[model samples]
Each structure stands twice: as structure tokens, then as C-alpha cells.
Target: MPKALVTGAAGFIGFHLCRRLSAEGFEVVGLDAMTDYYDVSLKQARLDLLQGPDFSFVQGRVEEPGLLMRLFSEQRFDLVFHLAAQAGVRHSIEVPRDYLDSNIVGSFELLEAARAYPPRHLLLASTSSAYGANTEMPYRETMRADHQMSFYAATKKATEAMAHSYAHLFALPTTMFRFFTVYGPWGRPDMALFKFTRAILNGDPIDVYNFGDMKRDFTYIDNLVEALWRLAGQPPPPDGKSVCAEDSLSPVAPWRIVNIGNSQPVQLTDFIAAIEAATGRSADRNLIPMQPGDVPATWADTMLLTRLAGPITPIPVDKGVQCFVDWYREYYDC
Candidate 1:
């Protein structure tokens, strides 16, 4: 079995990825800081489940000095999935430094670690926020994402550029995927679906941002996990031609950026309806204006993924929301 290393293995997405990779015959090494970013218990629970014969968990922060370097030196990873990130749009407003520390500095450290010991394929998790201020509906990977709307987006965009430089100069085969608004079982508490579910379940009023007019390309976790697994083996080569046309695939370097999303933008109200339907409870919603550093909508033009993977993996919002609601109820015993 090939060796795989995934950072932020305790995170919702990372946890799912590690579990899938372990199931798919990879000797997985999972790393996480286990920080109280949202809920440490949840992170611990995610990590605890990964403890098995094929999995090894490393407890450490990615930004910590000499930590990743040591791990890289000790283990020759066939693939390195950097999923750990300081993720938040509004929180970045409160503490912009955290974004810089985790997203930029930590990514630099990972590139340095990879520089010393290169993996067969290095995948970085970017965000759709990197497509900041690009009003183009259904964000494509090749769009001009020069104007970042938030510090979090800036740091993530910086990581993409930094990774590209490493790929071009050091010959590191890199794949960067811009994730849409992902939600599902074991999802982040900071996200919309989880919060809405919790508030509705507890019979509390839920804040409907953008006056409930916003649209999100709500991606299910399983679809994202499948995309990552498929992309891990499809890194661009050094001699590949940059797709000059409008597409997400990289042209010059052995690095490409693709969007992983459901490709369907469901309205916030509709999303809540799904939650309400799933939980059998109508939510008391407090309509609010758009929060700062937030886009009115986010849609992913997953044409590249569709062409490559043959019809983008999609889980209907109703079904996906119900799955999450079920998991939330079971996990919290609500």
C-alpha cells in the first residue's frame, strides 16, 4: 500500500479524507493540532475514530517550528494532502493574524518540508473565497481572482501562488482544489448547515444572512472526498501545456487548480427548508443584511471536474441536508 500523509486529519473534511483513504488501501498518517478553533471535542472525536491498524495519528500544529520538517524527514509520503487551514470569513475580521499564521506561514512550512522531501503528489486545499469579488456566476478556476474580499481569502490565494512557484521551480507535482461551501456529517459548527440545524433543533431563532437571499454551492462531504481521491493521482506534469482557454487546469507548471462543488446554487431559504423538512421543525429566522467579507453567492463552475471525472458527483440538497440532520441528531443525541 502507498503511504499518505494528511494534515488537519482531525478537521471535518480531513477526518473524512483519512477515513476514506484508509479504507481505500492507503497506509495513512494523520496530523492535527486539535485546536479549539470551534470545538475540540468534535476534532478529538474525529481523530479517535481514525485510530486503527492502518492509521497513525500525529499530534502537532502545522505552523509549529520543525514539526512538519521532522515528520517529512522520518516518513517518505507518497502523497501529502494539506487540508489544515485557519478557515473562516467573519472570524478573519476579528483576528486576521490567525489566517496569516496558519494559511500563509504554515503553507510555506509545508512547501519547505516538501522541498526537502518531495512527495509523488502534493494537494493543497484552497477555498472558493479565493475567487473573491469575481462576480462571474459559477466561479471557474481560471478566473481572475486578484481582488480578495477578506484576509482569509488573501492567505488562501497566497498559498496557491506559493504552491505554484514551488511546483514550477522545484518540480513538485502539485494539485490545488478550490472547495465550495461544503457541509455534511461531522461538519464544522461555524458553517451554515450545522448552525441552522442546531438552532432549529433547539427551537432557537436562526440568523438568515443576506436576508436569506444568498446562494451557496452547497457541496456534500462525500462528493468532495471522492474528488480529492480522484485528483490525488492526476497531478499535472512539467511538460504539460497550459490550457490557454478558460479552464481550471494549469498550463505552465505541474500544478492545477480545480473547483470541487455541487455546481448547484440553492437559496439560503430553500436550504433552511430542507433542514426544516429533515428535522420536522420550522426555524424561526431572523433576516439580516449581508455580513462583511461575505459574498452574496458562491457557485463553482466544475466543468474541469465534470470533463475529467465524468459528470460531477452531486448529492441533492434535500438528501444531503437530511443526512447531516440525522448525523447531528445522533451525534449530539438531541
Candidate 2:
């Protein structure tokens, strides 16, 4: 069986990816720090669902010295997914040091390890927030994303550059995918969909930032996972040319960046309405100004993703929101 190493295995995206890889007959090694960014119980619960012979769990920080190096040496992963990072825009503002440690230094450790033991494919998760302050309607991989409004985005952008250098120098096959707003069952508590669901079910006021004028191209977890799985097998060659016209293939390395998103931006108010429709409760809106490090809109141009991974049929926001609500009720016994 193929050996796969997934960092941040306890994270929302990492958990889903590990489960999917394991079910596909891969020997999966999941590494997570299990940080209390929200609740350690949630991470533990996700880990419980992934416990099986094919899936092994490791409790450790990726930023720790020699942690990833040791694992990579022993496991010799055929595929590596670097999904672990300090995730949170507002929180980054509060503690920018965490972003430097996890996003920058942690990635440095992983890159060094991958250099020692090269994987068939190394996929790193990036965010659409890296497109910071751009007013572009459909943000594409080829667009300029240098001006990041938040420290979180700056670190992610920096990682992309760092990964690219490794791919160019060490001949490491790398693919960095930019995720829009990812929401689904087993979502993180800090995300809007999860927070909205919990507050609405409890009959509490849901904070509506920017007076509900924001928009996001929310990608469903299942669809994103499928895209990721397919991409794993379709690593870019060292020829440094795009197979498709819209491809973001690098000019000097076996690396590329793809945006996995629904490609359909939905309004914030409409998103809340979907939650209301799902929960059968009207939300008490606490309209407020847009917080710092927040963008008014985010839409992805998924042409590159489609070209590389074949056709991607994304789940609609309303349907996706309902799925999360159903899971939340079942999990919390609402």
C-alpha cells in the first residue's frame, strides 16, 4: 500500500483528508499537536473516528526540532500533505509569533525533511486570504498576491515561496492549493458556519460583520478532498510547463498552485439564511463593523483546479450548510 504522511491530522481539513486516504487503502500516519486553539476534545473526537490498523496517530508539534525529520526517515512517505499550521486571522493579530513558529519555522522543518526523504508528491494547504486586499472578482493562481492584509496570509504566502525554492533546487514535486472558505460537517469551531450554527441553535445572537455584506466562495470538504486525492496521483513533471492553458505550473520547478473552491461566491446574509433554514430558527443578528484582517469578499477561479484534477462538481452552499447543521445536532445532541 502507499504510505502517506499528513501533518495537522487533527485539524478540520487534515482529519477529512486522513480519513479519505485511509479508506482508499493508504497506510496513513497522522501527526497533530492537538493544540487548544478551540477545544482539544474536538480534535480527540476526530482522531477517535480515524483509529484503525491502517491509520496511525502521533501527538507532537510539527515545529518541534527533528520531529518531522524522524518520521520522514522512518516512514519514507510516498505522499506528504502539509496541512498543519497556526490557523486564525484574528488570532494571528493577537499572537503573530505563533504564525511565525508554525507557518514559517514549522514549514522550514518539513521542507528540510522532505529534502532528505523526497516524497512522490508534497501537497501544502494554503488559503484564499493570501489574495489579501485584492478586489479581483475571481482570484486566480496567476494573480499577484503580495499585499497580504493579515499576518496569517503573509506567513502562508511566505510558505509558498519557501516551498517553491525547495522544489526548484531539490527537484521535489510540490503542489500548493489555495482553499477558499472550506465549510462542512466536522468543521472548526472558529469558522463562521460552525459558530453561526451553535449560536442559532442556542437562540443567541450571531455576529454579522460588515452588516452581512461579505461574500465567500465556500468549498465543501468532500469535494476538496476528492480534488486533493486526485491531485496526489497527478504530480507535475519537471518540464516546468502547464498541461492546460489555465495551469499555474512553475517555470523552473515541478511545482504548481491550484485553487480549490466552489467558484460560486455566496453572500453572508444568504449563508445565515441557509443556517436558519437548516435549524428552523431565526438568528438574532448582531450587526457590526468589519473586523481588521477581514476581507469583504473572496471568489476563486477554479479553472486551474479543474484542468489539473478533472471536473470538480462542488456542493452548493445551502446543501453544504445543512449537512453541517445535521452533523452538529447529532454530535452535540441538540
Candidate 3:
């Protein structure tokens, strides 16, 4: 069986990826710090599900001294999925240090460990927020992402550059996947979908930022996980030439940055309607202006991922919303 080490195994995306990797017949090593960013219970619940015979758990911080080095020395990971990060947009404004610690220093530790024990493929999770204020309608993999509104995005973007440099310098096979608005069952509590669901179900007013007029290219978790699993085996080869001006793949590294998103953008109001339909309650919305570090809309250009993953980038928003609502209902018994 192939061995894969998944960081942030207790995170929303990490949990889904871990489950998918285990199902795909990989001997998965799940590592998580189980930070109380939201509720530790939620993290524990996800871990409980992944705790089967094939999956092993390690409770430790990725940025800790010698933690990754010791792990790499113990086992040769065929693939490494670095999904762990301090995730939050507005929170970064108040606690930027956490982003530096987790996304930057943690990734540095992981990379240094990989430099010691090279993996066949290394996949790192990035965010569409890294696009910053790029007003491009459809965010392409090949775009100038120079302006980042949030500290969270800056750190993630920094990690991409760091990973690319390592790949170029050491010939490490690396893929940095930029994800747009991922949501589904077992989603993060801090995300809009989760917060909206909780508010609507509990008869509380859901905060509608930007007067509920924002749009998002919300990628369903399953579709994103499938794309990630397939890409694990499709590592990019060294492309040491500046062949063209259009390509985003690193010219001197075995690395590529692919955008994974639902090509369709849905209005925030429509997303709320999906939640309302699922929970049988119209939301009492508190309409507000767009917050700092918030974008008005995000739509992805998935030309590269579609070519690689066969035209199935995102599930319908209504279906995806219903799946989350159902899971939420069952999981919370409400």
C-alpha cells in the first residue's frame, strides 16, 4: 500500500482528504494539532471517523521543533499533503502572528523535513484569497497575484513561493493547489455556509455581508478531494525553460499551481436560500457591508483542472448545500 502523510487531518478539508485517501487504499498517517480555533469537539469527531485500522493519528503541532524531521525519518511518505494552516480572513487582522507561525514557519519545517527525505509527490493547499483584489472575473492559474488584502492570503502566497523555491532548488515534485470557497459536510464553523446553517437552524439572525450580494465559486468538498487524490499521482516534471508568457507553471521547478473551484458563481442570497430550504427556515438576515479582508466575489477558471480531472470541477450549489444540511442535521441530531 502507498504511504501518505496528511497534515491538518482534523481540519475541514484535511478531514475530507484523509477519509478519501484512506478509501483510495493509501496507508494514511493523520497529524493534527487539534487547535481550538472553533470547537475541539468537531475536530475530535472527525478524527474519530478517520481512526480505523489503516489510519494512524499523531497529536502534535506541525511547526514544533523536530516533529516533522522525526516523522520523515521514521517512514518514507510516497505523498505528502500539507493542508494544515491557520485559516481565517478577518481573524488574521487581529492575530497575524498565528498565520506566520502555522502557514509560514510550519511549512518551512515541513519542507526542511522533505528536503531530508524526499517524497514522490508533495501537494500543498492554497486559497483563492491569494488572488487578493484581482478583479478578474474568472481567476486563472496564470494571473498576476501581487495584491493580497488579508494577512492570511499573504502567508499562503508566501508558502507557495517557498515551496516553489524548494522544488526548483532540490528537484522536489510539488503541486500547490489554489482552492476557491470549499464547503460541504464537516465544514469549518468559521465559513459562511456553516455559520449560515447554524444561524438559520437555531432561529438566529444570519449576518449577510455586502448586503447579501456577494458571489463565490464554492467547490464541493468531494469534488475537491477527488481532484486532489488524482493529482497525487500526476506530479509535474521539471520545466526549466521560460517557454511562454501564458503558463503559470514554474520555469525552473517541478511545480505547478492549479486552481480547483466550481466554475459557477452563486449569489450569497441563493446560498442562503439553499440552507433555508434544507433547514425549513427563512433566515433573519442582518445585511452589512463587506468586511475588511473580504472580496465581493470569487469565480475560478478551472481550465487546467478540468483537463486533468475530466470536466467535473464542482457539484451544483443546491445539491452541495443540501448534502451539508443533511449531514449537519444528522451529526447534530437536530
Candidate 4:
């Protein structure tokens, strides 16, 4: 079986991705810091489900000086998925140092490790927040992403640049995918869907940011994982050949960025409505101004993704919301 190393394997996306890789017959080694950003027990719960012969877990921070180097030297992973990071737009505002350490320095460590022990493909998770300040709808991978509204986004963008340089100088086959508001079962409590479900079920008011005026291309967890599975097999050509006119493949390096999103921006109010429908409860909507380091809207352009990995049909908002509620009700016995 092929070996894969997934950093941040206990995180929302990391947990789901590890499960997917394990199911696909990859011998997956998951490494997580298990930070108390939200709830460590929730992460431990995810890890519990991931325990198996094909999967092993390691507890440590990716930014630690020699952690990644040791793992890379030992495992020599065929595939390296760099998904570990301190994730939260609002939280980043309060603690910029976390983003700098985990997102930037951690990525640097991973790159150096990969440089020493090269993997066939290095896939890193980026956020749609990297598209900050771009008024353009349907964000494309080739678009100029110079202006970032949040410190979180700025650090993610910095990783993209850092990865590009490594890909150029070291010729590492790297793929960075930008995720747009991913939500589903086992989602993070900090995310809107989980918080909305919890609040609505408990008869508490859900805070609708931007006074329920914001829009997001909320990609479901399964759809995002499916896209990632396909992308893993379709790494950029080492010769730097473009797949099509819309290809974001670099001219000098075997590196590219793709937007994996639903491509349909849903209003924040409608998202809350989906939660209400799922839980059979009415949400006390607290319309509030947009938070700092937040954008009014975000949409993704997945043309390159489609051209590269075939079509990825997204799950509708209501249906996806229902799935999460069902999982929450069972997991929490609510």
C-alpha cells in the first residue's frame, strides 16, 4: 500500500481526509497537536474513529523544530497532505502569533522536510479567505490575490508564496487547494454550521454576521474530500505543461493552486434557515454587523478544477445541513 503523511490529522478537514485516505487503501500516518482551540475531546473523538491497522496517530506540533524532519526521513511518504494550521478568521485577529507560528513557520518546516525527503506530491490546504478584498465573484485560481483582509488570510497567502518558491527551486510537485467555507458532519464548533445547529437546538439566538447579508460558497465535507482524492492522483506535470487555458500551473515550476468550492454562494440567512429546518426549531436570528477581518461575500471559480479533475457536483445547502444535524443529534444525543 502507498504511504501518506497527513499533518493536522485531528482537525475537522484533517480527520475527514485521513478517513478517506485510509478507506482508499493508503497506509496513513496522522500527526496532530490536539490544541485546545475549541475542544480537545472533540479532536480525540475524531482520532478514536481513525484508529486501525492502516492508520496510526502521532501527537505533536508541526512547527516543532525536528518533528516533521524525523517523520519525513522515517516514512518517506509517497503523498504528503499539509492540512495542519491554526484555523479561524476571528481568532486570528485576537492571536496573530498563532497564525504566524502554525501557518507560516509550520509550513516552512514541512517544506524543508519535504526538500530533504521528497514526496511524490505535496498537497497543502489553503482557505478562501486568501481571496480577501477581491470584489470579483467566482474566485479563480489565476486571479491576483494580493490584498488579504484578515491576518489569517495573509498568512495563508504567505504559505502559497513559500510553497511556490520551494516548488520552483527544489522542483517539488506541489498542489495548493483553496477551500471555501467547508462544513458538514464532525465539523468544527467554531464554524457557522456547527454553532448554528447547537444554538438553534438549544433555543438560543444564532448570530447572523453582516446582519445576515453575507454570502459564502459553503462546500460540503464529502464534496471537498472527493475533489481532494481526485486531485491527489492528478498532480501537476513535472515538465510544467498547462492542462488548458485556465490552468494555474506555474511556468517555472510544477506547482498550481485550485479552488475547491461549491461555486454557489448562499446567503447567511438562508444557511440559518437550513439549520432551523434540520433541527425542527426556529432560530432567534441576531442580525449583527460583520466582524473584523471578515468579507461581505465569497464565491469560487472551479473551472480549472473541473478541467483537471472532472466535474464535482456539490450537495445542496438544505440537504447538507440536514446531514450535519442528524450527525450532531446522534453524536451529542441532543
Candidate 5:
């Protein structure tokens, strides 16, 4: 079996990917800092489900000096998934240093490690937030994303540049996938779906930002995981040849950026209605202005993703929200 090292293995996406990889017969080493960013217990619960013969867990931060180097030297990972980072746009306003440390510095550490002990394929998690101030209806990989509205987006964008340079010099096959508003079961507490479900079920008010006028592509976890799995096997060659014209493949390096999204942007109000229908309760909306560093919308241009991973059928927001509500009630005993 091939060996894989997944950073931030306890994170929402990392946890899901680790489970899928382990089940597919890969020897997976899962590392997480276990920080109290939101709820460490929730991360721990996710980690619990990943315990098995094919999986091993390490409690450490990716930015810890020499950590990735030692691990890379010993394991010689066939695949490296760098999914761990300080996530959240609003929170980035409160603590910009955390994003710099985890997203920027941590990614730099990973690139250095890969430079020394290169993996067959290296994938990093970026966000649609990296699109930043671009008002483009459907964000494509080839678009200019230099103007990041938030510190979080800036840090993520920095990582993409950092990884590309390494790929150029070291010949490492790198992929930077930008995820649109991801939501589903085992979702983070900081996300809108989880907060809305919890507040609605408990008869509390849900914060409806931008007066409920915001829109998001809202990709489901399962669909995102499937896209990731397909992309894992399809890494760019060092020669920089691409499969499509719209490919974001770097001209000088074996690196590319793909957007994984539903390709169907849903209104915030409609999303809340989905939660209300799923939980059989109505939300007490506390309508508010858009928070800092928040755009009114985010939609992904998934043409490259389809070309790279084949056709994709994304779950509707209603169905996805229903599944999440069901899991939330069962897990939290609401």
C-alpha cells in the first residue's frame, strides 16, 4: 500500500480525506495540532473515528520546526495533503497572526520538507475566499486573485505562490484546490449551516449576514471528497503540459489550481429555509450588515475541475442541509 501524510488530519476536510484514503488501503499518517480554535472536542471526536490499522495519528502543529522534515525523512510519503490551516475570514480579523503562522509559515515549512524529500504528488487546501475582491460570477483558476480582501485569503493565496515556486525549482507535482463554502455532516461549528441548525433547533436567533442577501456555491463534502480523490491520481507533469485550455497549470512548474464547487450559487435566505425545513423549525433571524472582509457572493467556475476529474453531480443545498441536520440532531441529541 502507498503511504500518505495528511496535515491537519483532524480538520473538517482533512478528517474526511483521511478516512477515505485509509479505507482505500493507504497507510495514512494523520497529524493535527489539536488547537482550541473552535472546539477541540469536536476535532477529537472526528479523530476517534479514524483510529484503525491503516491509520496513525500524530498530535503536533505543521509549523513546528523540523517536524515535517523528520516525518518526511522517515515516511517518505507517496502523497502529501496539506489541509491544515487557520480557517475563517472573520476570525482572521481578530487574529491575523494565527493565519500567518499556520497558513503562510506552515506552508513554507511543508514546501521546504518536500524540497528535501519530495512526494509523488502534493496537494494543498486553498479557499474560494482567495478570490478576494474579484466580482467575477464564476471564479476560474486562471483569474487574477492578487487583491485579497481578508487576511485569511491573503495567507491562503501566499501558500499557493509558495507551493508553485517549490514546484518550479524542485520539480514537485503540486495541486492547489480552491474549495467553495463547504458544508455537510461533521461540519465545523464556525460554519453557517452548523450554527443555523443549532440555533434554530434551540429556539435561538441565527445571525443572518448581509440581510440574508449573500450567496455561496456551497459544495457538499461528499462531492468535494470525490473530486479530491480523482485529482489525487491526476497530477501535473514537471513539463507543465495541461489537459485543457483553461487550465491554471503553471507555465514554469508542475503546479495547477482547481476550483471545487457546486457551480450553483444559493442565496443565504434559501439556505436558511433548507435548514428550517430539515429541522422542522423556523429561524429567528438577526439580520445584520455584511461583516468585514466578506463579499456578497462566491461562485466557482468548475470547468477545470470537470476536465481534470471528469463530470461531477453536486448535491442540492436542501438535501445536503437535511443530511447535516439529521447528523446534528443525532450527535448532539437535540
Candidate 6:
């Protein structure tokens, strides 16, 4: 079995990815800080489901001085999925230092380790927020994304540059996938879907940000994971040539950035309505202005992704919302 090291293995995306890798016959080692960012119990619960002969878990921060180096030396992972980071746009505004430590410095540590002990492919998780201040409707991979609206996005964007430099200098095969509002089973507590579900099920008001004017691509977890799995096999060629007209593959390095999203932006109000439909309970909506470090909209141009991987058929918002609500009811006994 191919060995894989997945950082941030307790996170929403990381947990699902670990499960997918194990199911695909990869011997997976998961590392997590178990930080109390949301609920440690929830993280533990996710970890509990991952215990098996093919999977192992380690608890530690990715920014630790030599933790990654030790793991790389020991495991010599065939594939390294770097999903660990300080997530949340609004939270980053309040705790910018955390973003620096986890996103930037943590990525540096991972890169340095990978440099010392190279992997076949290094996949890093980025966010659509990195496309901040771009007014374009469908965000293509080759577009210029110099302006970032939040510290969270700024740090993530910085990682893309950092990873590119490493790939150019060290000839590492790297892929940075930009996620757009991922949601589904085992989602983050701080995300809108989780918070809204809890509030609506409890007969409490849900905060509708941007006065319900915002829109998001809202890629489901399963779809995103599938895209990632397919992408792992489609690493950029070492020749540094474009794969397609819309490809973001760097001309000087075996590095590329792909947008993994639904490519269909849904209004925030419609998302809440999906939840209401799923729970059979009407939401008490509290219309609110957009928070600091929050964008009004996000849409992805997945042409490059389609060209690289095969066609991606994303789950509809209603179906994905229903799945989450069903899981929430069973998990929380609501």
C-alpha cells in the first residue's frame, strides 16, 4: 500500500480525505494539533471513526520545530497532503498571528521537510478566499489574484507563492487546490452550515450575513474529496508546460493551482432555505451586514480541473444540505 502523510488530519477536509485515502488502500498517518479552535471533542469523534490497521493518528502542531522533519524521515510518505491551517476569514482578522503561525510558518516547515525527504507529490489546501478583490464571475486558475481582502486569505496566498518557489527550486511536484465554501457531513462548527443547522434546529435565529446578499460556490465535501483524489494522480509534469489553455501550471516549475468548486454560486438565502427544507423547521433569520474580512461572493471556473481530471458532476445544494441535516440529527440526537 502507498504510504501517505496527511497533516491537519482532524480538520473537516482532512478527516474526510484520510477516510478516503484509507478506503483506497493507502496506509495513512494523520497528524493534528487537537487545538480548541472549535470543539476538541468533535475532532476526537472524527478521529475515533478513523481508527484501523491502515490508519494511525498523531497529535501535534504542524509548526513545531522538527515534527514534520521527523515524520518525513520516518514514513517517507509517497504522497503528502498538507491540509493543516488556521481556517476562518473573520477569525483571522481577530487572530492574525495564528494564521501566520499555522498557515505560513507551518507550510514552511512542511516544505522544508519535503525538501529534505521528497515525496512523489505534495498537495496543499488553499481557499477561494485567495481570489479576494477579483470581480470576475467565474474565477479561472490563470487569473491574476494579487489583491486579498483578509489576513486569512493573505496568508493562504502567501503559501501558494512559497510552494511555487519550493517547486521551482527543488523540482517538487506540487498542486495547490483552491476550495470554495466546502460543506457537508463532518463540517466545521464555525462554518455557516453547522452554525445555521444548530440554530434552526434549536429554534434560534440564524445570522444571514451580507443581509442575505452573499453567494458562494459551496462545494460538497464528497465532491471536493473526489476531485482531490483524482488531482493527486494528475500532478504537473516536470517539463513545466501548460496542460491546457486555462491551466495554471507554472512555466518554470512542476506546480499548478486548481479550483475545486461547484462552479455554481448559490445565494446565501437559498442555502438557508435548503436547511429549512431539510429540518422541517423554519429559521428565524437575522439579516446582518457582511462581517469584516468577509467577501460578498465567490464563484469558480473549473475548466482547468475538468481538463486535468475528468468531468466533475457536483451535488446540488439541496441534496448536500439534506445529507448534512440528516447527519446532524443523528449525531446530535436532535
The RMSD of every model to the true structure, in order and in angstroms, is 1.2, 0.7, 1.5, 0.7, 0.7, 0.6
Q: How do the residues 1-334 of candidate 4 rate in per-residue lDDT, one tens digit apiece?
A: 9999999999999999999999999999999999999989999999999999999999999899999999999999999999999999999989999999999999999999999999999999998999889997889998899999999999999999999999999989999999999999999999999988998888888888888899999999999999999999987887878988889999999999999999999988888888888899999989899899999999999999999889988899999999999999999998
* Candidate 4, residue 99: how far the Cα is off, in Å: 0.9
Q: List the residue pairs that clash in candidate 3.
A: none
Clashes of each: 1, 0, 0, 0, 0, 0
lDDT of 5 by residue, 12-80 (tens): 999999989988889999999999988989999999999999999988988888999999999999999
For candidate 2, lDDT tens digit of each residue in 4-123?
999999999999999999989999999999998998999999999999999999999889999999999999999999999999999999999999999999999999999999999999
lDDT of each: 0.91, 0.94, 0.91, 0.93, 0.93, 0.94
Comparison by lDDT, 3 against 4, better one: 4
Task: Indicate the worst ten consecutive residues by lDDT in candidate 6.
Answer: 240-249
TM-scores of all candidate predictions against the true structure:
0.98, 0.99, 0.97, 0.99, 0.99, 0.99
- Model 1 per-residue lDDT at 94: 98
**Runs in model 2 with CA error above 4 Å?**
none
RMSD of 5: 0.7
Better of 1 and 4 by lDDT: 4
State the lDDT of candidate 3 residue by residue for 85-197, as single tens digits.
99999999999999999999999999999999999999999999999999978998889899999999999999999999999889999999999999999999999999999
Worst 10 residues of 2 by lDDT: 240-249
Q: Which pairs, if any, clash in model 6?
A: none
TM-score of 3: 0.97
